[model samples]
Target chain A: MTIASITGIGWVTPMSMGCGRDYKTLTAEAGKLPKLTSRMIFGERLPRFGRLDGYSKLGFAATGFALKDAHLDQWVEKRPIGVIASTVYGCLATDIDYYETVVPEGGAFASPNLFAYTLPNVFLGEVAIHFGLTGAAFVINEPELSGIAGLRMALNNLILEECSIMLAGFCDAGRPESFQYPVEVTPGAVFFVLEKTPGDETLSYGDLDMDIEGTIFFKGAQVQNLQNLMQRCIAVQSI
Target chain B: MEIRRAEIKKVCIVDTAVVTALGNTLQDTWKRLIKGDSGIGPIKRFPVGTYDSRIAATVDDLRPIQDRSIIYDLIGRLLAGLKDIPQDTALITATTKLGIDNLENIRRKKAARAGDVLPSSMPEMVSGKLGLKKAGINVSASCASSTIAIAQGSAMIASGQADAVLVCCADIVTEFTFSGFSSLKIVSPVPCRPFDKERSGLTLGDGAAALFLMSDERAIQEGRKCMATIKGWGIANDAFHITSPAQDGSGLASAIEMALVRGGLQHEHISAISAHGTGTMYNDLMELTAFNKVFCGRKLPVYSVKGATGHTVGASGGIEVALATETLAAQTVPPTAGFQNPEEGAEGMISSKPVYLKGDYLLTTNSGFGGINAAILLERGTNL
Candidate 1:
């Protein structure tokens, strides 16, 4: 079996936003707190952000950063390269919006755009279509550990030769005013690219730094988001 | 697909259970499907006559208990006789929308439990009810969710990482999905007529099914009833559209061809095909195109249970696979319910009466809103 190596990283946090390898500049410029915007993160690469919900926006921006870090930004590999993402409350914002469109009196004011993103897996579709990934992609719903579980599934697929490269992570935004969850959350997304180890095809990718766990094996990785990368890797798939 | 040789493993489904609109159990559901019974009717959750559509294939008992609880009940009934779960058993769940009914209640200021709105709660409920601590996956591949779940579960077992896997899928007819499809103008007022020239759109439904899968060796050692063997599976994305299939059916054909290649079989060996057949103009047409292209008009006899069971969304794939496996075991092909006439591409390939065949293989396919396609190949129980 092939051991998956985390080669590229990208994250969105309350205080930082960039590729995973830019630890020094991110730390030095840590004072620039909370600098993750659609324009700043995605530039002019992605589709118009006006139509997308917040969850898709957060995930799309992080995916763009990961693709950049993996040097697959403008290329489409003939081989299979997929995505797997887990979310705590996947698109709850849009779910609320879509639901408010209907009434009990046989009147519905639903928006087709909002209805499209209601499914949690739509995030994977957005990243797949945007990045031109046409392989086996999956969406997992769990706690923060969903990210690690997503990574394990990605590795399993890679080992089985189902896909050559994978982008696995978690993205979640706080619930709207009406809906109440057992736990509170912040708007965040963290994604990483995983590939089989010892590959000369991806030397352009900086280094194989992080493991299956969310731990950053690199130095000067004391950022808050780095310290707590989507909760912890709880080894949920080791059945 | 470029076919490649693979070291195949022997994974077989030991037992199965279902809670469909047609019936509560697999046997009852099979009888209704074989007889071409229509489980579709007018919507009762709310007034539907005001909209362009008014019919759906809803479960007889969708009220009083939450829709998410149906999976729990089904799993409990399925595992009632089991005393213990194998330590190596894993869980893989699939559903496109989990607890959307509860979310709708909250939006309408109706009484709703907080846990119903949580997606993780479904798997957590399954694990907790089954008395397990390890985490499991909840797949959300739109309509292909459960198909991918079963495929991935089989993959895990075949790869020697898991001894058994519990695969479950469920989806309920909700105002969210009903109105969403209605807003898209794809919900039929009457029963959906899949593959028929006059077919208008799909009919949403509520249901769930569970399958306990294990390797053939394990099943024989434990003396479990191996219903069918999971021969092969495949997944692909069209990258074409967000809510529709590729115009030429290339993505679906790729998935079907890959499943056949992986199963080490040819089109001549396949006895029947279970299509996605959502009754939408594009979906049925695209599936027919793929079938004609892959089978080359061999009269393989394609059928879609959606007309009888309603489009169960996430649960349709798993239920269809289970029914197809049962058909293989019994040596019969269920009729394509509500199919009055075959469309242009599917001429002579669909029938309204149960067709008996003496082949070992069945090809099942499903496509979702995100241009994702999944196909699975199964062998008869006797072959295993």
Candidate 2:
């Protein structure tokens, strides 16, 4: 089993954006997410923010908020912080968009900018470059436990001492317009800052635990997905 | 509650299987590799009149199983070679694009398996085939997918989290991928020339590889022969560019240093290296620069198989690991196909002729589009 302290939480949904958001309010809202702007990213102006695809924008915003909430916004040198994220229909929407340009011009019009974001891991790279995180970063896709799996991998990296801190979460976008598959999902992102030990002065959401079998628990209760863990964090914080 | 760290355990590669454009089995591929054969040819899978690159390495006479994705056929062929897999073994698949051709079909208003379009479907398909009760996860880092997956699985076993782990990865050269690389202006019109001064770019390929890793105690209990032992593994990111590598090669150098540190081994302990060597100007240059820094300007033996198999994307690392085991067993490093003249940084490192191994340890490294870099150090198995 492995244990880590959830020092910070950041999420972006249709209803709310930023760290320490109310889970109930987010669950209550049922509408399309507003267009994310650079101003929403903790007052830091990102010149490339407008150029990012929707999926990258959502993930980048959540991670930016996560680091800021954890009081790690400034970097004197490159930090050994890692990021692992889970997705189901990762970059498929961008892929279709990129391919559309290829079909018309017989590959001559294929957008290089769009092709760069075809893989799901590209967003993780954006986060890493912006934060100067030189630790291990990758993306995982799981049908079930989509969010929890990323957390598990992050905790494993922490336990192995691969890095002292890790940012784990899930990021997904709605199905592409031309995609024939029917995948039920909301376009959003959620991230948690996990540290090997709880530091002084920083508020910890709770102790997160995972068994050898990869089963996860938060506050002694089994959690299936990131939403469940978020609700648990909100419930515990309220008390 | 008590805080406990996982006990460090020894992890061994009990078995490996591979199916690539060169051959359908690891033995066949190894035989062709040592003979210095090239599998890259004209791209007949799709029309390339409008594309910059017209050739790629493809599995000959391959048809999609049940009109689904070629991935199924590749995985089936790969899984057929394995005899016994532990029931409790967890699975971790690696692929940048899982059955992406299915999406192309769907877009063209043709019949397709919609579920296969999702990356998660890969693990589902593998779990069903393996009859594994535990769920699986799919890693989707670009070119470095399988390398990271292998390292992750080894860490799981070494940390006592899993006794056995099945790491499988596959990626096919589809029009979607071909066009993407072409648009990026990195696909070589002719076959790739790794480490050559005239090296142009990478050539995509179709392949799949599986590595079954088990803890030393479990492998002994199962009476499985150890093919190789994972001594150390490390992963790092350049954090420089999304698609470009750092010119200084600092990120890759850091990863290599970490691997040596974690293995409790010194730089001199490594005998040779299996480089990523995509043949792209930046990738090959960045790798050579990193090698120079890590080995401290020593002319260590380095070889790449991309010229023979083309760039297999996600399967490149797993396939290279299989070849690494063969290198240890045969005590020889195969020649780099399509290589003649060496680039400036590759003068003393890379060779077009086979080099005999002098030590038991070999280091394999891969870097990808996300600035992701991973290295794994393998020691010769006792039986070998």
Instruction: Write the residue-wise lDDT of candidate 1 on B1-384 in tens digits.
Output: 111234335789887878788888888899999988988987787656557888888775555455333334444554453445665567887887767777766666677676666667767767777766565768888999999899888877666556688887888887778888888888888789999999999999887888888987788888887788888888877777778888788778878887887677888888889899988999998898888788886778788999999999998888998898888988888998889888887887788899887888999999997778899999888534
Off by over 4 Å in 1: A25-38, A45-48, A76-79, A144-146, A197-239, B1-8, B66-88
TM-score of chain B in each prediction: 0.93, 0.97
Give the per-residue lDDT digits (tens) of candidate 2, residues B243-361.
Answer: 99998998899888888987889999999999999999999999998998889888988999999988999889999998899998899999999899999978877888888889999
Which pairs of residues have clashing backbones in candidate 2? Answer: none
The DockQ leader among the candidates is 2
By summed lDDT, the worst window of 10 consecutive residues in model 2 chain B runs over B1-10
Best by lDDT: 2
- Considering just the first chain, candidate 2 attains a TM-score of 0.93
Per residue, candidate 1 scores C-alpha lDDT tens digits across A95-176 of 7787777764554666677888888777667676777777777688775443656766665666556677888787777556
